[model samples]
Target: MVFRVDMITLMFGLKRYHHLLILLGFIIATVMATEAMIIAAFPGIEEEFGVSSVIIAWILPAVMLVGAVLLLAIGSLGDILGKRRIVLACLIVYGAGVALAGYAPDMPTLLISRTLQGLGLAIAPLAYALVAEETPVEWVATSIGVLAATYGAGSFIGIMSGAFIIEQIGWRACFLVMVPVVLLLIVFAWHIIPDHGIRKKGKIDLIGMMLFAISILSGMIAITWIGLAGISDPLVWICIGVSICSLFLFLRHENQTEDPLLDLGMIHEAPFPEITINAFLVVFSFFILLQVMPYLIASPAGLALSVIYVGILLMPGSLTDMISGPLAGFMVSRKGVVIPFILGALFLLFGCGIYFLFPMTPVLVVCIWMIFSAGMSILLTIDNMIVVASAPPGSTATASAFLHTIQSIGGALGPIVAGAALTLYAPEEAFTVIFLVVLGVSAIILFQSAGIRRHLP
Candidate 1:
């Protein structure tokens, strides 16, 4: 009777969380759907504003910068206030930003509005925290896997359908249509997401937030300016200088503050550094696409595939990513972190290897990339679960945000590192060099598996 009762309680508790997982998935999917549409519509937006591609290119970086800036504060805020509060606020702001961008009269307005939507990135950290706080520990990985799967499925749908939406309905409609979806999410989140973790007495680390935001913003701007103004540009140097100083101050302040934005001591520990760095490398490695794919498929040093064919080629990757996400998460629950993470790294390396080993055809390129995408999903899912597991008491959201912020920094460096290869080598050579560098990064992640094994459950 006792054993039966325990089983019943466990099953009943987990069943509710299944609904929570679904809710979180839909929330993340909505955010991703909007994000992918913007990427697909970049050309149309550039043409609409009559701006040079160079000027309009800032749109993507602008969103990334805002996400990095807000993540620290949002994470901390969610911890002190409530995850539900923060999640709903992010949805509302993101929806407004998207809606405003649809009718933005000028380039500046559109840019600002688009950047505002980056607040939606807050939902990611909150999502992990919510599951960690609510779901059973043994089941957390499976739940995270579901989230990762949805992320893959969402991005694929968004990119695939987004391309069509941008073409038939116009770029404006892409942003405009998403407003209703966001509104629906806001409703779902309010009613469905349980509110718990509220620490009204906790202080907001305003100064720390400012310094961190400045550092991330300035540093990313430096990288962005390097592409725009050249390596020797004074603007780039100035931005770099500001970023360093802000970071020093931010670190110093955090060490002294009672309620710091990020508890450095908690994260500066073992496994966290190794895992977060690996996450960075994972993103930095994957941005090979940002550097190579467009040029490889459509440009002069190219397979010269049509747009439709390129889309078809990428279609399978989405499925692989969706599958790999849940698979990795499940592996972590069953097999522990080391094996799954190392496997992910191996998959990434193998993906890179195929490009060098085989002749580069459109079909081969697409098929090989699926392996890399799957690896990416696995590594990221494991990485997030680690953060979720390692979260400081009462600061789950803050910890998850910190990890993501690190990943975001890596994301910022990805394009710069990949683009540097292009400048130094011919297009084909550059692409090859970039993949080799990515392989090197993946190799390091695999190497760390041995050291990190003792740290995981």
Candidate 2:
């Protein structure tokens, strides 16, 4: 009887939960590809639509606005609703959005379709939460690492494949490519992603969702308009003011509510706050590099390579991400988290230093960037692990969403700050500013490395 029960448990657990990593990988890769392809195809899209660069930029801004506002709300809903149901719904919505985007006849239609895509994109964090709950403790880091690397993988694929498709077919073909990919991935996800047996049954906090969404919407729109349009615009100023006021109210609402969307107390954990701050600054600093290398490679300042060759340079950074993510996970699982976190920060600092000192040498720069990218990947991969581990049971999704939402905000701000630096100084000088900030943040992390290790699993 004992042997039979053990066998039954093995069969059910193995069949149900073993491939959580793989499913999350597929989700991350698909979502990243979707976002990256849209960004890569922007030039072609602008030309096709007969719009200015600024107008084309609005496409992504619109998508991001929706995502920034709604991700936490959607994630909380995932807790109330079944995560699998939300994942399925999001996949269908994403696929339909891709199809609509592919056939968009004008800018308005494209904007609408992209907004739909953003709503779907908000599900990415929910997927992360699902993986956190379902994956075994032994391999959680590796699992999250793969999910982290998927974004880099997607960016690499999008930059390379989107350019090829635009060259061979047209910009519209890029959107069409995702439709099939989404449909296929969704089918696999439905098959493999096991249902976590615990379910929360309750009414979602509608008031919290509305206030949070409004706050995020106003903030994101203000930021977007300031970055792409002029900050002096009356609309931008109004949005900024409204965002501030709304966010204050939103926080107050969440704080007073019996069941908050995000319980504010979780962030008070030692590692959680430190890691969150580190992730924000590191992402903010490195994301500038995303544009920097591409700009240098495209412009006269650097190699002036074709989009194809530039894509190759991006590969090292992404390939490093692919390797570092899993390896960081393993390190955290075995050696503990602090060493990897410190090392990741050091690599980012090194990358910035190299870029500042050797701005003219493309090959050297790429090599330095690989170091930075690998380190950044490690930090990100481990940070997720840290966040999940730090949180109390069942708050994994909310914690993950909170961290990622901040990282997204950092990513949004990075280019704007870097772009401004570039306008004022040489590329090297701008990189100096970026890297100094990164190094300063890393130093802070290093100082508290011992404290962080104390808190980790």
Candidate 3:
């Protein structure tokens, strides 16, 4: 009875906050869903284009890398140009990119279209900032959690439906179908989101932007190339050296710049570093599972599952995340962020540990994946909450952008790392090794979670 009253009070306390959260959630979900949609369509694309697996692999990473490099710059632009304007422009670009990708006549054309679509990746961080700015303090975490849940839900729908759509109407049509939905979202967002809110006064750090872009592009290319080609390749080493030096220079430049792209001082603060590092690690682990699972299930040496079956196997994880996301928000609202954060880490630890010990089988893989996804849902929600809450006032968008840039880098690395593992070892052994490494990383994340408790609200 008391709980119900509190819930009612909470619901009524915020004036139309739910509508804003839902709209922002839908926008973030649409962008994220496009990512999964492409992943689901990869096999079909490979078959149609007659491309080698290595070349097909570049499609997703190309998008992720482009988006990763541009995210911080776009976030800063949002601060300067207005979040609503930037987001609306991104949607237009994204929709056009998708449409072009749907009609792409060659692999290069499709790759270019995918990279263009990535321009909208800025929407996620910008939306997070808007939510943080608009929502009351008490409701902030819950709002973010719901947004995360919707993102999971969107991914689920995209992956599951994408496979079926490809089976029926071809993979190109999959991109085409989303065009109208994105258009509707553009219209909806225009009305719901406030046009004028916060604006920072300063020119964009163009030098910092260029440095960061080169650093990220070089680093991601090096990582991706290392997976595709062996470490012995001279180009890989050159890229690695270039990436390292560029990053060092970028960091120095950021430290010295007045209006830096990343705001180095905020990144140096407590919880921010921990939060960002863990974001990278967790996404790194999750992407390994994501990229590898389809191959694992479909490979003849493994289960030899169909594309539809592969999608089915992965569906539960998204569904579990969809359910767990809101629950994680409630837990954060009631019990603080630490409990959910710790539980999330522990869940990932157990999930990876299970796969390490067990033999690879379709059923066992799906079951353990569910466990992993549940943990991931909690972590995604809490991580966003912590990042948004811990960010210095007026810098929420930049902080969220910085965190996502790290995550995008991790995402870009995941398939490459997993691909390299498969190339280096037999399928069975490679999966086992991957899980073992992920298990170790999850443990490290668990330990890191303990340090953030003191920093949480």
Candidate 4:
């Protein structure tokens, strides 16, 4: 018998169990790729449906809302049942969603189909939880970094190729192609990902899940509308009201309940809150860059670069982002999370400061973006590791869901902040404002990290 070694494992320093890592990475990639591809395919979908952008815009928010709303429920459920079981179910739903989304003949059908895809969003959190449970403690950051690198690649491919696929083949192709890919992954995951019936003993916290769903859904609706509708919009106020009341109730319940969706006592412990808060800030800060860069390159006020040039210019950042993930993991393993956290924040701070102070030349912007991407990537990966490390023994998934939803709120705000800044000011001034805000956010990260380091042994 001949034995073959995976070069990928050798590169990552993961011994014999790299297959699990690869499978999880593929799952993350699929989710991220689908998101990017669908966004790219949106224009074609709009044309086909013969609907206004406003009418169709709900699709994106709807997808995100489902994920945010169900994350806690699903993650908690996964803890009670089993992560592998829940993940397999999610993959099935997502595959179906992708398949139907491709061939949907009407707006309603497409909406339903895509919403199904949103249901699968819990898989990413589950993936993290699985890694925490299965991998050695020392390798957690490195493993997650590899997955994050895959996310970067998936996003890059989806964005770059999605448009071309939309133009050459059709919008449906963008989605249809993933169906088989997902199906194959489902098979691999089902057979190989382990189902030793690992689960916690608890009842599903239905009330907590309901309140959390409403809270997240309402808040997201408000965030989605506030930029377009302004602060005074009645619907906006109504959603905000609901979100706040529900969130208040949800927290109160978590504190008192026997079968809580999230263990409030556990999460409230030191470093966890710190980790999540920094996650929110890093997500919020980097998201602004994601929203602004395309406009910066394409707008007459900025570079006015051609679409082709835009992809070429941005590719380096994504590539660097992909590379940085494992490297950051290595750093975390050697030096611990606080050092990487501080270094990452400094990278982000410097990136924001340089972009703010200097002119927007192509070379300069790319370099700044690379630095920013690296910084954000590191923080994002570390955030997951810390959450897993801090979570109660069997509740990694639930904790991850909490972190993701909070980060989602920050991610959601990225566009609103950019829109308000850019809409209210000249292009140059808007860019300045955006980076300045991120700089401030990064400063918070830096201060928090410094504080954390002071307390570390």
Candidate 5:
């Protein structure tokens, strides 16, 4: 009788906070879906706007760059101000961006809308921070895993549905569909999430913010320009020089600042640097596959799959991620992060290897992609947990943002690097180069995993 009673109480206890998980999942899904849905439709947008391939390539990276540059600053703001307040503001901007994107009359207008939507990138870290703070320690990893799974699910929806919708009603309608979804999320977030939570007492670091943004922006732009116009281009070299100077200035400012946007002290802590570096490498590896695979599929030399068919082929990977995400969380809860991290690294290496060895057929490619996606799904979940765990109490959002900044840098660079390879080399050679690079990175990740394991408590 007592055992039954205890079980019932535990069940109800878990259920009591289920709404928060749902809200976080919804937000995560929305953000991921919004970002990914446009990827399959890139060719469509390029055709409609009559833009150059380089310009078309810039679209997704532009959004990622804006988000990457602003994430740390916004995260610091959430730490100083309230997270909920930041969430509400970002949602408003996101909705407006979606609306504008749907109605965008030209390439410039679409780019502007994407930049606006980038502001919402802060929501993921903030949402994770909120959940981390509120959830019991025992449930933290699982909760985060659930959100990670939801992220994969969102990607699946975005890619699968976005392709279908773009095919059926045109790409503009795809953006329009998200506007209402964002609005609904805003309403739910406002009502469900607590208005007030933890807030750090500090003034904003204006100099640090500016320098950091300039540094990241310049560096990313320089890379893109190199890819587009070659390293011999004067503009490319100029941007590179600017990036180096800005980065130096940002580092100096952060080291000296009284209230740094990203605290140097915290970042220096054990496992933080390792985890952050790991995140950068992981995203860099995963995105090479994500961005390059589409080109390979659609290229005449390859399978030459249509946009919708390409989406269908890639769907399994996202679905695998959706399934593995929560499983990663469960593993973290029981065995700690080291095991999951090691397993994820192995999976990533295997996934990359599969592509290297296999013949490029639709069925074989789909199977390999599913394996790769599963690896990424696990890594993504475990990495988030590691970041959250490494953070100082109440600074979860800031730590997450810092980690994401590195990851976003990887995300922004992946497509550019792949695009550059494709532009410079034959399709087969370019793909081989990409896979070899990713494989090398995966090996580095595996090495790092060992180091992490030795340090694990």
Candidate 6:
């Protein structure tokens, strides 16, 4: 009896970390569904609200802008409050947003609900931090990589399922779907996720938060307005000016503060900052296709693949992402960071070459794109591990959040840039241009990897 009890306890000790992972998967799935549903719901909402397609575009990016602006601060807050607690609060915020979105009676109300949904986006980096802190060192890389890949998985499932749901049920049903998922995640998270540690004690930086929020909001709005509404609009220029000034003030404040929302010193560290910048470039470069391709396929120029076909093409990317993520974790565990990062960069370059060679042919391009996505998956997964590993003991969430924020900002910018280029040039030409630019960035990443030897921490 004593032996059996001891064996049971030992087995549970090993399995305990998995509870956090389960929570992570659930959280990722819910947030992804929320994001996809908002996009899928847009056409329905636009029809009901009588808004233009251009106007509908605002619904998603606006939320992203809010997420990007708040991610670092929220992560820092998590560090100060406790990852599980902050995540619970975020879940409530997310659930409330979904409920509101479901019942929204007007365009303004729907927009507000969507904005609230964005609050939940911060959960992702927090999840990474939690896994990093809780999982054993042997499993850390693999677990974190898998957690990272869950986002892609969630995205795949959500978008594919969301379209079908929207068609069969109704637009409002899209938001309604989240209520159940969020409830489940909240319950699991409450039961499973361990308390990481106390957040640093301090008063929340309300002013800093305001300044940062204003800057990002203004900046994103300007970018979107310039692309959709025209750069000549007076409102665009006003936003631009406000964004620049607010950004300057925000940075200055960050520098002066004792308990700064983000310790910018992390940016100066080698490999962390460089790798994060690479993450931004990757998001800026590859994520553009995420937006453009779907539109193009649905339009006259593409193979006019149905949502199902598009989902199929996306499958390999997510699969490669899923496989590569753990592979990266394993590689990083045995071999150091440089080799994995270098291989990923080389793969990206090769993938870009493939894209440049075969842009027009949809079928062949999807295969090549998978190669590209595989490379990105390797890089992103490892890069996130690097971010968490590089941070000071307590600041993992903040560091991950900053890195994620950069990626989000890039995701926000990609569509606008790609869309504009497509508008001005031919699709083939636009693809070539995008690939060439990505190729250049990939080369830079390769060159930067050579310096990784200098910064192993």
TM-scores of all candidate predictions against the true structure: 0.89, 0.84, 0.92, 0.86, 0.93, 0.87
lDDT of 1 by residue, 21-73 (tens): 78889988887777666555544565678864445555655566677777878
The residue-by-residue lDDT of candidate 6 on 138-241, one tens digit each, is 88888987886776677667666766776677678778877987888788777676765645776566677788788877876776676566779999999989
* lDDT score for residue 243 of model 5: 83
Give, for candidate 1, the lowest lDDT window spanning 10 residues: 1-10
Instruction: Report the C-alpha lDDT of model 4 over 1-457, residue by residue, as the tens digit.
Output: 1113356457877654467788888888888777666554544565688864334555554566667667777888888877777889999998999999888889999878877888667787888887777787767778888987987777777766665676678777888998999999888887657664357888878898899888876866675566556678999899999999999999999889898887788777866778778888888787677667766776678888644445556667777778878888888888887788788888899987887576788988788878888888888888887787777777788899888876766665565566556655677888888888988998998888777755332
Candidate 5 global lDDT: 0.81
Query: Which of 2 and 5 is ahead in TM-score?
Result: 5
- The TM-score, computed over Cα atoms with residue i paired to residue i, of candidate 6 is 0.87
Q: For model 3, how does the per-residue alpha-carbon lDDT over 1-457 read when each residue is reduced to its tens digit?
A: 0111235446678455566787788877787777777666666676788875556666777777777888888888888888878888889998999899899988999989988888767688998898898788877777787888886788788888877777677778878988998999889777667766667876688887787777777766676666667778888889888888888888998888888888888888877887888889888888877777767777776788777776688788888888888899899889988888899999899988887577778778788888899998898778887888787766778888888888888877776677667766787788778788788889998998877777554
> Clashing pairs in model 1?
none
lDDT of 2 by residue, 1-457 (tens): 0111235447666534445566667777777666655544544565678874345545655565566566676666677766777788778887888899889999999989887887666776776787777767666677787788877787668767766676678777888988888988788767666555345555556787787777766765665566456678898889878878888887888788887776777787677777887777767666656645555665544566655555666667767877888888788778877788778877876766665565466587568768988878888888787787776666666777777766766665565554545544565565566566656655665565546666654
Residue-level error in angstroms, candidate 2, position 240: 2.9
Q: Rate the local accuracy (lDDT) of all candidates.
A: 0.76, 0.69, 0.79, 0.76, 0.81, 0.73
Superior candidate under TM-score, 2 versus 3: 3
Q: Going through the candidates in order, what is the number of backbone clashes in each?
A: 0, 0, 0, 0, 0, 3
TM-score, candidate number 1 = 0.89
- Worst-scoring 10-residue span by lDDT in model 4: 1-10
Q: Which ten residues in a row have the lowest lDDT in candidate 3?
A: 1-10
